[model samples]
Target chain A: MNLDELYQTVILDHAQRPRNYGELPQATAFAEGNNPSCGDEVTVYVKLDANGEKIEDIKFKGAGCAISQASTSLMTVKLKGKTVAEASKFEKTFHDMMTAVTLPEYPQGFGDLQILEGVRKFPQRVKCATLGWNALKQALGGNSSHDPVTSENE
Target chain B: MINAEQLRNDFPILHQQVNGRPLVYLDNAATTQKPLSVIETLDHYYRKDNSNVHRGLHELSNRATEAYEHARRRTAQFINAASADEIVFTRGTTEGINLVANSWAFDNLKPGDEILLTEVEHHSNLVPWQLLAQRKGLKLRFVPALANGESLDLAALDSLLAPPVKLFAFVHISNTLGLINDAKQFCALAKSRGITTLIDAAQSSGHRPLDVRDLDCDFLVFSGHKMAGPTGIGILYGRAELLEKMSPWHGGGEMIAAANYESSTYKPAPHKFEAGTPNIADAIGLGAAMDYLDKIGRDNIAKHDMELAAYAYEKLSQLDFLRILGPKTNRAGLITFVMDGVHAHDVVEIANTYGVALRGGHHCNQPLMKKLGTPASARASFYLYNTKTEVDRLAEVLHKIKEYFTR
Candidate 1:
């Protein structure tokens, strides 16, 4: 019922000064995702290791609500150095953490992506949390030149 | 011209505080909130006259039927159609268009026959025809927008007009662009070519005065909720003879005259199309809504909305980097725009911070969005209850947004 609770300090910190806040100029793998329902959009640029399996660098740039931008900030930080396989697994793990009847056990040693647990109370912003992860899967899927296309996950 | 400040008092929702500020709702294009009268009508219907119609001889059912049928007659006369029998109630404008495209276009259109539509049609209008064209093997032709220097060619419409042009299904006022088609010019042209025109009056009916008999448009459709009426009810008007010719869109109890094993004769026109139990309460509510509009005067309401739209367009256009993406002429009661370097979602969120409610995004018009080369826009539309002050507040929000983002 509290709007203040929805915009907690953790969410605002990531929103005001997002972690991976700029474009990677040398990003060979890129994908742009847009929420057709609300017009929230984010384009992710990922510099992959030469094999295009592990993320070397990742960043996002777009305009949206505070929740959306911060969620993207949190998502990208979770994505760096993650293998394509691990990035895909993190997609399911992130969703479980956000909207479960019971919270999924957070994996140890993973950093600030856990902050997105705030989004579980606000179900509407799940699109914001997943926007970056969707782009990562597309980039690593070897269709890096293509804009992010809708899949079963989208 | 209507006392907009006084008019705002009747809407309970508009008077409320949002984020410690007055709720300046300008999102009529998306959904207009319920007026007190409309809300009361809903409560009254359920509390008193709740029953099935036409079959029950009981007092409640009888009154409910009378109110429901009264709405049918009002909807018919609101558009100046010949009679109530011609009005077919559907779920909304999307279903209404699909019914026309499938039952009429699919049946009548053959290969090489052209179905003409404007470039700015809502996806509801555009998509049904797209699917119909594909399925029926008919040529779906578009009257692409007249872009300055983008096309030195004559309006493709004039050249596209041919004898085999079977139908002209286009919006009376475009949902996104707010372009009010000159019914005389466009309808006259389509009539001359023997094109059976279906005007999507979804935008025009409440915002402007429309006369189907006067416009000479063969088919017209408008949704209820757009005009301060209840949702889940829409009007589809077809010429009486044409209604006689076209088959029913759905079939069930009320639509049928008699049913045996494998053989059934359907009831005439409107009833035949209206399958199952109708939105009886909302139908009555639409009648109340029309009565409310008539009390204010439709012509006066129309003029008032146009005045607000023109004012909003002028003031909003003058702001730095604010672009109104619609007709420059006297438009319908809305201005779809985008501020420079600020996305529409951000604009909506920032505007919400200022207690201004508006619509953002492509507004269900993907083809038009692609034509304009933008993903989405922020729309501050007006209605009878909207004011120049709200427009001024909108301009202030954009000014503050430019400050918020750039400075």
Candidate 2:
């Protein structure tokens, strides 16, 4: 219910100036995430290391509400340089944080992503907060299918 | 004039607060709040005459069937249909359109026949035809909206209404843009060409007085919920001759006159189309809603709607950062706009903090949004109960939202 909590200063800043934005043409894996209800869409592109086991870089390109854009922007900053398994683990943790009935204790090493926990209070916006993470999860899930990942299905 | 302040008292839900603020329900286009009469009607039906309609011989069954049939007659009268037999009940506007598409178009149209629609149709009006076109090898054409994104390009109608265009289906009002199309003129044009016409009056029915006879459209569809009735009830009015020609879309209990394992004889037009046990209680509730609206006078309500929309549009236009969609004048009871730096969802979310409910998204008009050059926009729709003061509140909240996002 607190507007300040939902639109944290850090989240707003990230949304205004997203990190690692735009297409990664040399990317190995990429997937699009869409929230059809609100018309929010983001494509997360991942560049894995030589072994294809670790994400060397991650980037995104799309337009949406601040929660969606910022969550994806912050996600790129968190997942880069982490192994695919670790990224998947973080995704599960992030999903839990967003979907929890009450504010769970902040998971360590989540960094600025903790600001998104405010999304838990607004049930309708949970999809907006998770849209980007769902795409990143899809990119790393090895399907790399052409069909855009939807938050509704996840 | 209808006193909105007095009318607001009839809606119990409008008195509540959201997030510690008085709720300003500007989402009327999505669904209008039900009146006490409608709510009581629903309760009365379930509490007293709760039985299956059409076939029951018991006292309750007779009451239920009479009430259900009375609702059908009320709907026919509400829209000024030539006869109650012309009215078919469906889940809502979407179901009504799908019913016509499946029953009428499926039987009549041939492969390569084109259906003329507007660029501004809601998905309900567009998608059914798309599915039908794919299935029957039919072609589809569109009448584009003007560059202003308000009115349909009537100039283009002549070219699009070529011989192959068998049916011309369009929205009576743009749910997103709030533009009221000239249904009468459009219907006349289609009729002159000997092409069948269907009007999507989902937005127009309760907000304004409607006469299917006056519009002269072969088929017209509208939802009860949009007009202050219960959900899951709507009307599809077809001309008597046309209704007789169309086959039944849903096959079940009430639609049949005689049944055997191999085949069954179907009832007349309206009953034949309505298969299974109908939404008896809600249909009766819709009748009550029509009574309530009639008491207030739909002409007065229509004037109030336009006044509220015009007032809201002026208030919103004062903000330098906002770009309003739809025509500047003669719009329905709504305003759709986008803030310069704020996403529509964010605008809606922040406005909720102030208890001003708004609709933000494609509003089931994705292609129209694309043409208008915005992914989505925020809309504040008014009804009979909404007032200029609420429009002021909306404008104030929008200003605060702009400052919050920009600062």
Candidate 3:
């Protein structure tokens, strides 16, 4: 249970400069996630293709800790060009890895997300890593309420 | 100044270690760690004087009633209330403020009457009034603080209290920013206008000696947990005449004189406010806490607290990227800050690896956070038990966090 494991180099780099971070201009779906205890809020936005099956673009806008912000940026990279069903599966795998004690098998395109596996050692911080992914799940599922999806509530 | 090293030993919880390091507790503004004296008092009460007060006519009841009533007197003396009758034991500061909002304001306030509050109120002081205003169609106005979200702008208070201001409720100290308000001046201004005032002393009551009479406020409320006492016990000090005029906030066995099927005659001021069985053991423990504080002398405690805060401030301010909240001078015993590229929760998460406990959030003042334009900040509060060495550890942990994030 090393501190370096939880705050690896890749996570810090992504948090410093998040990718595809901002509101997507009127395309598909949006939802917010929060770790209420720490005041970390992450709002995720998704834009689907013509058939509404493939995610054309994804963005997020909010303020939060490093783990949440980084996970959100990395989620956009994994989600773009993927079908909605595949994105949901990736989200499930990510959530499972975060909460799982033993190292779970990483799904496809989950290479970068393996950095977040360290969050499982720290139970309280598991939510910080999963906050953005939860919002992504809600957005792709077409839940429009931006009332903040908390890990505790789920 | 008080001897923090010696005092730390009295608090048994502080003797332990966290994360393989000596625990550094900087969350006193959230709740203070209790001394052995207070703990022993609680243990003794439950073991020996366990009985229902004001109901049983037996020997244990007599002892329990005496101890409980004695606690009220002790609390009144500690706060310099006019009398023990004015000290009503409540669940905590939240319940005390809610009691006032429900019993006093509900009975006296009109539809268009306004209640003036400051921007730095904790949720306990803010939400109860918001609920009341919504229900009764009352107007609620706020006196915005200075740009730093620390102290109130006294100049703006005059304008905000222009007309129809029924009551002014403000915190004696901003819990999030550690800014001490000029409660005496605020209460005097409200008094001159013939408006009532209530001071939320949840933060001030523990670190300093509070004389309600000197403050000249009609009502003052504070929690025991924040002041080295047990939880589930607090005191609401109201003027005797005002308490007599206000309606009872709760109803049950001990608060009534005569109960009928439809109508009942309620008891006097404090009794009427305290319904059912109170937190009798905690109240007794609070009395012991009062005695402990008296022995240390609050003036010394206040000096010690301020010195620690100043040390932490000076040390943490050395970090160029850190933005510390609150005014530099006349601050209470805490420091809230946010790093340039790191979030507060991340700072707290990293600090935990070094055995530091900091509060990272809005501190239940979400509206104030929005007003200050800071989404969140990490707060490290101090008390008599905290040492300058702990402040150094905090600074070191913070430096490591900054390095970790920036690297």
lDDT of each: 0.78, 0.92, 0.89
Q: Tens-digit lDDT track for model 3 on A10-70?
A: 8888899899989899758999998766777889988898898999998998888888888
Index of the highest-DockQ prediction: 2
Model 1 per-residue lDDT tens digits across residues B227-309:
88899988899899888878777878899999889989989888888889998988888888888888888888889988998
Q: After superposition, which runs of candidate 3 have C-alpha atoms over 4 Å from their true positions?
A: A34-37, A99-109, A144-148, A152-154
The positional error of residue B6 in candidate 2, measured at the CA in angstroms, is: 1.1
Docking class of 2: medium
Clash list (residue pairs), candidate 2: none
Off by over 4 Å in 2: A100-108, A142-146
**TM-score of each prediction:** 0.88, 0.97, 0.96
lDDT of 2: 0.92
DockQ winner, 1 or 3: 3
State candidate 2's TM-score: 0.97
Tens-digit per-residue lDDT, B1-407, candidate 2: 98999999999999998999999999999999999999999999999999999898999999999999999999999999989999999999999999999999999999989999999999999999999999999998999988658788888987788799999999999999989998999999889999999999999999889998899999999999999999999999999999998999999888999999999999998899989999999999999999999999999999999999989888888999999999999989999999896899999999999999999999999988989988899999999999899999998999899888877
TM-score of predicted chain A against the true chain A, for each candidate: 0.81, 0.93, 0.93
- Model 1 stretches astray by more than 4 angstroms: A1-34, A38-53, A57-78, A82-93, A96-122, A141-147, A150-154, B147-154
A145: Cα error in model 1, Å: 8.1
